[model samples]
Target: MKIQIRLVLILFNSCLCLYGQENPRLDSLLNVLKTQKDDTLKVLTLEELFLEEFYTDPTKAKKYIEEGLELSKKLNFPNGEGFANYYLGAGYYQTIGKNDSARYYINEALDIFKRIKHEEYIIKMTNALGVVEYTSGNYQKAIEYYNIGINYSRKNRHWDNLANRIGNKSLAYIKKGDYNLGVKYSIESLKLFDSLNSKSNTLQLKIHTATAAVRVGYAEMGLKNYEKALEYFERALGIYDGIDDIVHMGHTYSDIGNVNLELGNYDSAIENYMKALDIAKKKKIPIMRGHVLINLGKTYIKKGDYEKALYILKEGLPFNEQFGTKDNLSLNFNQLGNAYLKNNDENQALVYYNKSIALADSINAAEILSDVSLNRAELYYDIRQYRNAYLDQKRYQFLNDSIFNSKKSQQIEELRTIYDTEKKEQQIALQEKEITVLEQQAEISALQKILLGIGLLLSLIGIYAIRQKMKRNMLEKEKVDAELEFKKKELTTHALNLARKNETLENLKSKAQELKDKENMGRGYNQLIRTINFDLQDDNNWENFSRYFEEVHKDFNSNVKTKYPQVTSNELRLLALLKMNLSSKAIANILNISPEGIKKARYRLRKKLDLSTEDSLQDLVLSL
Candidate 1:
């Protein structure tokens, strides 16, 4: 059994290694595939070849998987078709980073598995769903699917599958910041692998154990247990070294560097990070290179080498922007800010900090938000912007607390779910025992059984009725939301129309004045100019327009006035026009002022609002 498993592992790794640069195995595989006459064998070979390039060359992997899928469909091989779809989903997710497409393909594969009642593949595909959710940062949903997969694996006594699911759960916990629980699950997975008696599969078990160790190390790092983290990382490194896993070895080196940096072993950290960076570059791993660059740049910042830090960080920006993970991008931006700040370039620091915050907010990355907010608050304090400093400090505290509480809540909910499931299972067993005993009772009457059946039917009918009511309520709520959105659009359109008409009247008055000036001493032209000027300056028309504008943008004028009480009425009119997104020339024509005058008014408005040069007056007005 152990020898057979070892051969399987060798074959799998050999297939993957075929895609490695300078490998002769790829040409050998292609030669063999070309000579193969059996369609089934050809499809199987294509699947193996596709997995080889799945991560390293996704475009090529996709072509191979599509060919395999087409062949399987033509051969009416449902199992082959399901596997092909699964790999296609995995390729999209891990290589191309398209979670939606991944989810769709995985679901399609899942349907096929379910239709064929393939329990083992169903469990694997369910675990794949967890992986998709994990990549999407839906930690709680990922945990749910992982739990489901684990339960199924356990019931089927599939120890290897169970270990993999547990390892995945550990990763999800670590990502969610429940370091303690993550460590617990990692240990549990290691124990399970240790208990397996497949001597022939010892290498496979060792690989699993090594992965679990790395997870534990990450959890320890998250928990700030640097010593424990180093121990686990070293252990994992040893295992990977034994297997000649250069990729994982590179990752472990970076992990060690992070711990060393945190412990203030700056020289050791730099050395380790440089080693990792060298490996990444040699292997052409863009993501690893980006991450190692960030770590190196941050280490330089800590060492007070601000210029070096900035150079390194800026070099990493394009790589990170192109292919790094979102978290890595946030870290790069934040590190750039720190480097700039250390160099006494406060303006550049602020720009990078804002960029970091924007990216973090878009991804709802609470951990990144906590770190960036604290750094931003300190930057604000250093620049003597006390209000902004205070606001950012508050934001940091809020996010820190939220992250802490969310992790705690998730852990508690997981435990509660497990407890509930176990308790319900126990109750089900007891009920089964009771039913067995009741079935042996000959004294039970036929009338009692009939009444019991009627009671169950009535209960099911009540459940159906409640479901119907819920469906109606949901439809009603959706209808109301649609109506509200339509009304909002209608109001905005009406306000814009009124602004346009007001601008047209002002333009007409300007044209009439020009005509009167060109044709001097003409009583009829003079009278026409007077009429146009009266219409343009008409207070009633202004009042009517203001009323309509306020209705569309409720309390906008009042909000601005409340915020900047000293703003003059002319500035208020300027604000209104700005809110409509009108150009400077159009606003000047509408307000009967020159463009230069409008510019001066905008400057004054900025002063009254205490806005920096970076702030857009138009955006502020529109937001209000």
Candidate 2:
């Protein structure tokens, strides 16, 4: 037993040593290649260097992938072209958080894979594509690709690959809200993984299972699974201790942080998030760094540290936007709005809320939109903007109803598809048995084969029908693509125009603000008198009035300046009163003048400004 324990300790030590050696060698090779002059050698070395760095140092991995892309394009090698694009896509997906662009390049590689007929490349790209789709909320499309990938792997007798594909398929199904099916496939995948006795895969399977359970809202089950996941993660961590598998380690910690967060263990969540952030910063992985920042912001928000939450989230928003994730941007904005509200900055809260709504609208992020609208309605209610609150509440209600109905419809559709598939499989099996019997009978009586000939003709007709259907489907896809491209261009143009208009409006607002500031500099007594006299300037104020008030409120400068080429400063006060929508009594009270005197001043101002009843004196002063 002592010898066995010592051997186990040695094995563990050896694993750590191997993991530690990986980073320094990768760093040294990367530095050497950075200064290399030969293009071919540089390209070749960079590709290998990027793959080696991907797990430990994704930011450096991205640099190498970019360099490889440029070299591959220069060399004009199709194989290298495919590889470079694939690497660049994965690099962006993994490091820059640009999954859409990652999907694009991965699809490009998939097209090349078909031309090259490389099964390994095809399966890998397919699995990657599935991941992209799954992340994008297209769970059905992801499952379709994963199924194909699984079939290919199985046909090639690649058990490890088949298990991985099955695991991915299970994740997609779970995301699609098919928990039973997800569990079924997950179990199958785990069984295969255990049979293979692959330690790496065993750890991965535990993580996947925990994640799926958590996503499906089975939190207790999730936590149970996560215990196993934690055991494996720690095992891996121990093996990789003192080694800089910073990128993978960071992601692992992030995963742990998320699980802990869901379980309401904020302290543990913070611990893991801080660890992830430290590694991400040291590795210079901007995307993962941004992710950790957002997660940290959430923890702060939950802890009621509104100021710190806002600071962290605002800093992280630009990174998320630069990475082209409108969804993440919307989340950040929503959080900011909430933080501002918590800090009692209602105006700022409204602005951020509106921004979040706009981004959510742009991305069709239904959950964000619903939550924002509800929050906005509550804010409006607090401000006594009842009508606006009612409108927002109604909108929120409508969205909630739609989401509920859509989810129900999707569930019904899923059930129907499952039922149809099972029925069709049974029919196909029975039909195959009938065909075998018919063939046996036909072979025994070879003279009467007209039915078999007719069946063959019918099969040909069916094949032709299938071909026609496929052709129609292809045409439909092309049409959809064209329409989508045109709409995308239109939206781009609209957004540009809207941005320009907003800029103009902001400038106008700034000018109005400057005028208000100037008014604040002096004129203290005059401003006070204007406010007081506005209420007394009606018909009742005619009996009591001051002569100086009569002088100041006698004429309207806006009118006089237009009619006589210049107006006195006293007349400007009367004109400003007219612009303020005050009654004659209010004007008299403000200027210590009689109502008749205020009326006289108003008439003089109107006449001086060359105003008419059709256009109010208020509009005239506003234009000036």
Candidate 3:
């Protein structure tokens, strides 16, 4: 098989510590929720409790989310409400693997965050929305959302978050079958987090790096670099093993099993699967166990153990229905269908395949849908249903083509061309250097002949050689200096271009606003919004505005960027609001700053542009 099954984590990396007994963190949160006298604190604690249980205990997580939301509303606590909504969304997607509920709750939370001007959670919820799309198999759309978060994280110096989003984007590319880009981005992300961890060296950073390494492994797996994939998975496994993080450890074990399975090492795959199952049973995470069970069933099928495959797939079905996302559900159904088909249960197999297809279509899961279509078509052909079989066969081809299409092939070919060109350039440069060396040597030989008659021949030749060496060294230094300068310029330009595209995509995303209180909420959320009142003002996309989608208002805020290219989105929002003649108090509240803070911001802006006191900051901003 060219394909391998993978264990997917959430958009953000969260840890679940499973103790042999009751978890202290969960117990503490439960105690706080029941006993805390502070109403607002109680609401916040409930949200915390939800996070603790979301992975292992979905029932409790849902209960806590409901309790948290109700109480936050009672106390009018916007922060409490925002977090409560956020986790409610996360639980739906991460725990249950349902996109409809997940999208609704995540969008709701995003709205709340925007309203309250919670910049951090706003970006986080945005990332969460991307995760929902990713699990739904909207890989390209997911990458767009991830890019927004990545760019925002870079500009704001949120290195940890930047790493997370970059890893996520890498996964999207892998799923989209852009394995080269997947490898490219994952390595960059791993290096970035590694550098950051060197400075912090925290346990959290270690976990982050481990999560990141797993993605790199997945990218390698996509590229069919099985050895490299195994290497990364083992490295991540080692980290999780050291931390005793059984949930993550289970994932890494399964990843290693996948490599062995791909290599036709069935016995090794089973061994690794058993190890993962042992951890899964001990920790009792329904979702993780479901994945392991399904994967084990696939291995059995590969081994031609049809009866065992059927049994395993059936056993995993309930757990998946209870905890898996739509992707997981579709996959579970597809596996069951496959097991049944292999076992000669044609009637049952067709039923399961239909179920899988329905779920896949609902979520636009091209990969799963394509596989199941082909599976069902074969069964239909076997049962003498020629017409139905033909239709399904056609569908399979269409979906497969859409996923592994010519466009993606062309893109990869383009990247290869660029890499090849750069390599050729380097080769040419090396040849030029070689020619220079040859010329220097010829000159030395000619000098030796001229000095042959003198007793000072050896000394003169030595002096000439030393001087040539010095000249070469100086020339090399100059070339290195010039290359360094060029590289610095190239890197800066690349960064800005990426940021610009990210901002443009973000703007396009938020063009449609459901919230009506635009003036009350203000447009500074994109800059920074921190308050207890969230009315949600859409402060957003520009060049793509002509493509049938328009912002909520028909203002020319988009034009400001064109006029002043130096201004960032965050800075542009401030300038846009001032140009609209909003009050200082309103602007300060929207920007989550005091009046003095605004003054300082304006002063800093002036300093950034090297403006004297006489030059108006407002005028400079308005000109943009």
Candidate 4:
């Protein structure tokens, strides 16, 4: 039994670790897949390959999964189809962060697992759903799914499964800010891990237990129990060090630093944060490095070391931007704002404060929003902008109240109580169902009749409401159509007026040029006429006309240019004039050129566009 449990633990953890390791047996598997005639073995090999490569190369994993899915369908193998869907979902979830697609494929796998009564796969699929919910920020829903898995594992005496589920639930509770429950579940998980005896499994369990301890420490920190948080973090760090888990050791150090910072031990906080930063850099973990930098910078600010804070924060800003986690980005910006404010650079401080608020509001990051809003309110007050200060203060109060609400804790406890009561009721009801079956059937029959009447009445009202909505939609559409027609006519009138104005300028330029060429005119008079002609032919006039033309026919130039990349700028202008439905003579007049030149430009444009002689350039430009 111990050996079997150890194998199960290894398999579960191996799923996550496989992507980081290169498999020597992968070549053998590929060889067998290429030579094997059996579709079942091929499908299995494909699933193995996909699982091995998903985190490292999701595109390759996707190709293997697609091939497996096709072969499975051809072979009418439900189990093969199910595994293909499951891994495809895992690839999307882990690599692309597409929770919806992940959920769809995972639910399909769940259906197949349920139909086969495969209890182990069903538990795995349930856990995957919990992960999807956690990724999407549905912490309560994630906890509910984790609880369901935990209950199943408990009933089946799956200790390893129960420990994993409890650990996951602790994380969800911590993320949701229900620290008491987080600590409770983390302790329970540690107790479960204590019973496992296999060497390899024991080490794995220790890592999981350490992770839970870190979470518990974080929960304690959130509750302002710095001493307790420090104790738990130190315990976690010891375990991580024992197992040589440098990644988690670094994280625990950072958490300890946070607790120390909250308790006003700035030096200790900075020391621990620098230790974590060194580990993060050594391990090439950008997100961890970014977070540690922010914490260290905040510690410097607490110690009134504004120069140090600003330098550390500026160094960390790029990492936060690359990490793209809005909460951390917002916090980084808020810290920068604080550093600038302390340094008496009000303009820079205001800029960073607004940037922080924008990022916080985009992600609805309430904790960061509350802190940044309070800082901004203080800045505004300092600047004597009392009206803005009051607005920001009000925002800070609202966000702070939401973040630290006592009701949330009470609500979480009430939910747990309700869940426990419901589970007990279900067990009791299952045991006594035979005795009360007939009585329950009669009650259900009467309730069904009442529900049917209510449903029918709702259907009638829904039909009436839908019909009224359709009538209103039709009227709105008619009004929109009328407005569009009026706008189209107004646009055409504006285009015609522009064309006539350009034609009048061309005629005045022609008369001026003729006067300049005459012998009767004095040199001064000829130079004035020449200047007037030059103004008429200025490129600024063309630029102004092009802007108005774009407003009316936005896609005309772009469509023509895209199709004819070799066409020159002069050709594009000719196309635009033709698109306005102007004749050759009118276009020549506007351009201050002969009609023959306009004809030659059109011919060159048509050739560049590769239009046949039978196709009219004017028609093509007008269509464009």
Candidate 5:
């Protein structure tokens, strides 16, 4: 709430005073309430007073809520009624486990907000419902609501709310025992808040960043990174200290206590928890008090003060049950069982352990179940119940394995989500930079005189058109060059085929002549020689090669002929082969000559074309 108010105040230029996180002193609010008339202002003031007392005194908060609801209904003010019901529902669920009543009042407010098309209130109520589910131990349902808020906030570019939703989602993951994922998402939330903070030095963004940091601490604590978790917790404490956020300040102190407890710093743990307890009691925050009380008792148990542990645990049990989730209550039971066991009260220890196990099973807290099962197993073995001990030992193994496997899958999913989120964050940053550049360009364009701006716009258009035309021409030239290359390869293939056929014919002609030299010449044998020679010199073979060559180098024939009027058709054919970049041996085969003869023919052609000694025949022909 503090984070949202600060953002709205700075970014939107003003914030709704009634909806702000700050509340007037009880005396001040009472005076205003007495003097204020029965209108919207009175209803709004009542709502604000309800919020001020909501976490501290549920009964007093309810008085303000009821009065506000009745007055708003009489005035037909949906927004006021929505705020009243929302606060009432928050009090019902958080103060006591009135699940049905909580859902009824919250949903009623939601319906009213929807009817009035109050999008912001709808989002707030939806998040509240999510918190309700989270408090009820419905982790998945809570995540679904957080996702809804994330989607809406992202679409609206409400970065503060988006960061809050993401931070809330991390809490759900932590509760669900997906600690790695909780850390990943909490870090993402921190980064977003940091980005917003970098954009402007707003206290709201800093508070949100600290809140995200605290969530990271919780997630790290879940992963057993005590020292690292302490760093985050202390950092957040520093921020909350600067603000009048009693609710978060107490929670942050409790988180620091938890890290100290994990690190075996019993004295430090007690100190932090006592600080949290002081804040919780002084501010009348039930949830914070309950949480700190439970941790304080656990700290004493760790310090080997069993009697102190037992007394503190018993004193905090009622508060924990009333305000905390069942899983936390189950943990408290397990700790109580441990304290009793340490004090050598076997019967009381067994009773508390059983209660803890039952609660853990109901909530499907596999990690808690595993711990309790192992503890019970040891107790049973101590009591000489071999069979019960063995059964609990098996249950512990099963739950431990299940939790390990569940964490493996969650880690895999988290890896993919982290990658996708990183990609999106990068894209968003790039887009924001682009928008800044565009805005600057728009400002520059606006500053330019109208006629000059028109002239510059016209010049840009003309330059763009000319550049486009050049690009098109270059593309067309490339296309023609590619076609020419293809044709050249095809022409080479045709020429090679003709060369092979000509070789066979020349061999046959030699055989026929050999026969004529060995014996007397016959008419049919001479006719065979003629046919072989004719086939060797077939124009049909040249026809296909010539056609492809012309297609490959369209201007070659005309340009060469025009340059050298004395050039013959045969020399032009040799020039075409040279332009194809054929080897001397290949050219010899195609022209029915030896390699030496083909080289000499090229030398003669070069001289005929008036080429210099330094000139490359292939380079010259290729250019043509």
Candidate 6:
């Protein structure tokens, strides 16, 4: 009996050692995977790695996602293909602009997630789908997805994840103009975050709460809340410092600045805004920077610095136009008009104000129209246009009354509740049942009146904004043309000087080619010159060329110095041109090289530089 027991113990020990060995093998496999070259192999390795250590490496998570995308298409792995598409769509959709294909792919992923019954993947897909809906301005649909995500996370006991989903849902509510509900969700998320001891998440919740507070007319409370928000953000800033989180940080600063502006702290607002602008520009985030610029312009306007306000607005305008961010542009134009009005530039002020009013209308910003009407009334009052002023004031009062009346607010709330209830019941199949009820006379009458007013305002605003932009663009073009004329004369002079030098170099190069023993060599020279010209013309290509060349010659700095001891960098460039067999003219045209200079350079290359007679100067340099 003792011997049998001993044998059993030995066998158990052996099995335990074998399990340990297996774990290290898995670790080793992942280590080797980091060095893998094949996309399929790397992608597979990433999948395995994620299963082992996904929480530790989000960057590697993204790498796996990208690699899996490339490999799935190659291997025709439908499951892998769908998952990769879903994650990539999620990643890109988290940003500002909306991509329809990403939304489509995510929907496909949702279907796949359902078919697979993969709970973890299903949760991720739903969350991503919600984000896509939010970005596309389908706030109610986004809220639905986020609610689903929150429920799933709660079921799974994923407290941190549940908190994030709740926060996302709050943002959707805020977007839908239900700030009261948004604040509730945000505060709930904050409680969860505090329980989890997640300071970052706590700060995020505070920011969201403060933003909602400000939007909902609790400005003083918002200001106090934002100070707390900024403290947390600053802590987060410290942790994220020296990292590539420029956009998020910029946004944080902008939010802080905006809050400060509302609190009437202009200096603090300006400081925060400038910090945001600096980071935004450094990151090449035009939309974010443009938003900051527009806010800065508004701040300046409030400070009664009309000239400074105009300057900031103008600076933001081009970026807004370039990015097609009409929201920011409209704000800048409104501020610019206000600044101009303060400067007593009545005609320009009116032009800018009209433009702002039109743009606000196009965007269906009822709040913006309210503000514009009030502004126009104030302007008319100041100018002693009493009748016009009174008319404007009445319009403003009517819109305010329509929006703020308890009856309308209650109706909106009721509609929201009905929509939510119907969605929860999946009442789309009972469409006739729902539509028939809505067709009841009282509801129909209320909707008809509301719709008529909204439609008229929207249509008028849309036409006016479109026309304003068109007119502004035409004016800008005329100014651009005049500027271009002046620039052209200067550019022409520079071109002629380079051309003259190139003609001389081309003559010298032609003589040199005749002297060479090589026959097929001339093709190489032409190709090289064409390549250089192409590189110089396109900024994108130039960047690619630099990157490619650096990749090929990792020690390029040392190599260039060692190989071209007698050649200055400029002379080396000239030599590179010569190797291309470009006529001195082409080289001069590209490098601003003179013809007489090219001849002199060639003579020096052969005499001062050691070259075998059998080796052509172009051929020798080409080898480098």
> Order the candidates by lDDT, highest first — what do you get?
5, 1, 4, 3, 2, 6
Whichever of 5 and 6 has more lDDT, that candidate is: 5
Model 2 poorest ten-residue lDDT run = 1-10
Candidate 6's displacement at residue 310, Å, is 0.9
Ranking by TM-score: 5, 1, 3, 4, 2, 6
Model 1, C-alpha of 316: deviation from truth (Å): 1.9
User: Candidate 1 residues 185-281, lDDT tens each?
Assistant: 8888778876773444566566666666777787788778999989998997898788776766777788889889989999999998888888878
Q: Indicate whether candidate 1 or candidate 4 has the larger TM-score.
A: 1
RMSD of 3: 26.2
- CA RMSD per model (angstroms): 17.1, 20.9, 26.2, 24.7, 27.1, 31.2
124-158 per-residue lDDT for model 4 (tens digits): 88887887777677888988988889889989998
Q: Each model's TM-score, in the order given?
A: 0.62, 0.56, 0.59, 0.57, 0.62, 0.51
Cα lDDT tens digits, model 5, 536-603, are: 67787678688878886788899998988899898988888888787777677678887889878888
- Candidate 3 per-residue C-alpha lDDT over 1-624 given as tens digits, one digit per residue, 9 for 90 to 100: 222224345344631211212245777777766778759877867766766776677787789878889888888888888777777776545545567888888888889889988888888888888877886768879888988998899889998889888888888877766676788778888898899988998777788788779888888987689999999999999988987777778878888998999988999999998898888888787767787888799999999999998998898899878766677778888989989988899999999999999999997777789899989988986775544664686687567547644444635453554356445655666566556655656666676645542434465457656766785566567545644543443333333332333332232224212121453533543322221112223222223222211222234456655655676766755664565455666566555456898887777667766789899877765554
User: Which parts of model 1 have CA positions greater than 4 angstroms off?
Assistant: 1-24, 407-624
TM-score of 3: 0.59
- Residue-pair clashes per candidate: 1, 17, 9, 0, 0, 9
Model 1 weakest 10-residue run by lDDT: 1-10
- The sequence of per-residue lDDT tens digits that candidate 2 reaches over residues 1-624 is 001111111111211111233233666886888698856667777877776676455676778877777777787655676777777764446234567898888888888878878878887887777766666677899789888888888888887778767767766665555554555666676577666655554443433333232222222123245565455455444433434344456655766676677667888989998998889778765666666777788888888888988898888887767652566677778778888898999999999899999999997877779889989988886774544664676577568657655654555555555555555655676577567756765775455566665676577568656765785566557545644543443333333332332332333334334545676633543443343234324333222222222333334444446665756666765555554455565555455556788768767877776778787766766555
> Per-residue lDDT tens digits of candidate 6, residues 527-572?
4445434433544422432343344334544555697687786676
